[model samples]
Target: MKKNLIKPIVAAALFGIATQSALAADRGTPREARELFDQAVKFMEANTPEKAFAAFNDRKGRFVRKDMYVFVIDDKGVYHASGAAPEALVGLTVLNTTDAAGNPLFRQMIDSTRSAPEATVRYMWLNRVTNKVEPKVTYVHKVGDYVLGVGYSAPRASADDARGMLTRAVDLVKKDGAAKAAASFNDRQGAFVKDDLYVFMVNMDSGKFEAMGMNPALSDTDARGLHDAEGHALVAEMIDKLKSAEDATVEYVWRNPVTNRVEKKRSYVHRVGNSLVGVGHYIE
Candidate 1:
């Protein structure tokens, strides 16, 4: 009886490990992607073009990890190798091709490699596992006549992250004053801009945006004219809520700055004196 139980326990442990590996295989973080990208570069450096392409084209090779895969493009915007789908994508001239968000990705990559040895670009790409487009950040390195690159999409920020960021932004406004806080909030590299989350503030009376974290150009835009992708007057509704409520959670459809896709967004708005400060997180 003890021996039977031991076999069952060992089998269960093996099953658990297999399950964990399966879960881990479909998802990868930016750090992991960068590490793999570095390893791929080293592999290419150590081997000839024939051997390097063979390793990259291998589906089960080390170059392919989780959702992260390696791709190589020539300066003329032609694909020489793609770890994900070599048969269909390799040898394709994609100079004019654009990403899901209409970003001229290959052209931009070519342009970037000409000026810098390495560069990073963020754009929307299809996550094969999710079958949906998500924001992807790729790091490209110029190697000989080919530009090798690797990218991974990050998980969108949760509702909790938005609320926590809002709390901090609110505290900053209360402590440092609105004018100073708006500057920090408008900084693209600032604390408020993370994943698919950002902070935007509006003047309740004027209904003009004072700060927009993702794009400061949207600042001074009339909030009343703002509408969601579905043409819902969401900003006007937010202003109406501020009339009576100290805090409100408004749901709307807005374009995610990271993914550049119109996605469901929920904003936690708080009335700070005459100004209304808000932070929104995209629903994944």
Candidate 2:
């Protein structure tokens, strides 16, 4: 009698374990997140910042409004145009604007665009109308010798909305067992992931590479063919050579062959049963 009872208990435990494992297997893994990030970057690059800026400036631009100020800048951080005060910022140097520590708050963004034609950055400024400090998002584009920037200010309420959207997306991905979820900034349709060192944009339709902010070296072709390109091939080789285990966290940096600027990224690939999933920052 005792042996019969033990067998049934063991069988029940095994059944429970199998059910849990199946549920886990059904959820997506980190690989899904990495793929989405890659796709978003490709989409961003296909749409050049200069063209995007022009569209924003057009009469029918999506962000054209009195409450929202859109503008462009140069490599030297001078204002190219400001929807709110174009004339006032025409000659002003943005680098001069510093925080209490005297650090150029825009340092990372400015450095990234020095070579590449486009990049994006975030900052805070005082709203003249409301007399309050607010956050601003700017997409910087380099054309010839000058840099062009398009920007919009977020109200406190809108900031909450943006954060909420991102959080919800992240939660959905997590609940679905996805390793990552990718999305574009509200004003700039470029890709950003929680773990990426920089943002990336590639054109979705044309398959053209546009810009990489964290790494300026990534060019049109480099950004376009990340998965199959020779550069990424070398990256995979390096990972295999130095990786401790099949599951090590690896960093991959690709410089544009033309600009020699670097785009730094990290990814972790894992095997769940027979399927492989990658998660991490492909686009920052």
Runs in model 2 deviating more than 4 A are 1-64, 99-103, 106-108, 155-284
| lDDT (Cα, tens digit) per residue for candidate 2, span 1-284 | 98788656533321122223233332122233233223323433466655544543453344333334345555677654444443334455666565333446555556767767566565565444444455444555545554444443333223234334334433443454422222332113244322122333333333333333334344345433455333455324323433344344446665422222354545443322222223334322
In every candidate, how many clashes are there?
0, 29
Measured by TM-score, the strongest candidate is 1
Give candidate 1's error at residue 137 in angstroms: 10
Q: For model 1, what is the alpha-carbon lDDT of residue 235?
A: 76
Q: What is each predicted model's overall lDDT from 0 to 1?
A: 0.80, 0.41
**lDDT tens digits by residue: candidate 1, 1-284:** 88778656533321122233344466676678889889888888887877877888786888888877888888888777777777656676778877777989889988998899889987777665455566678999988888899988755777888999999999998998888999998998888887677888998898999899988988889987888888889878888998999899999888876555688999999989878999988875
C-alpha RMSD in Å of predicted model 2 compared with the true structure:
22.4
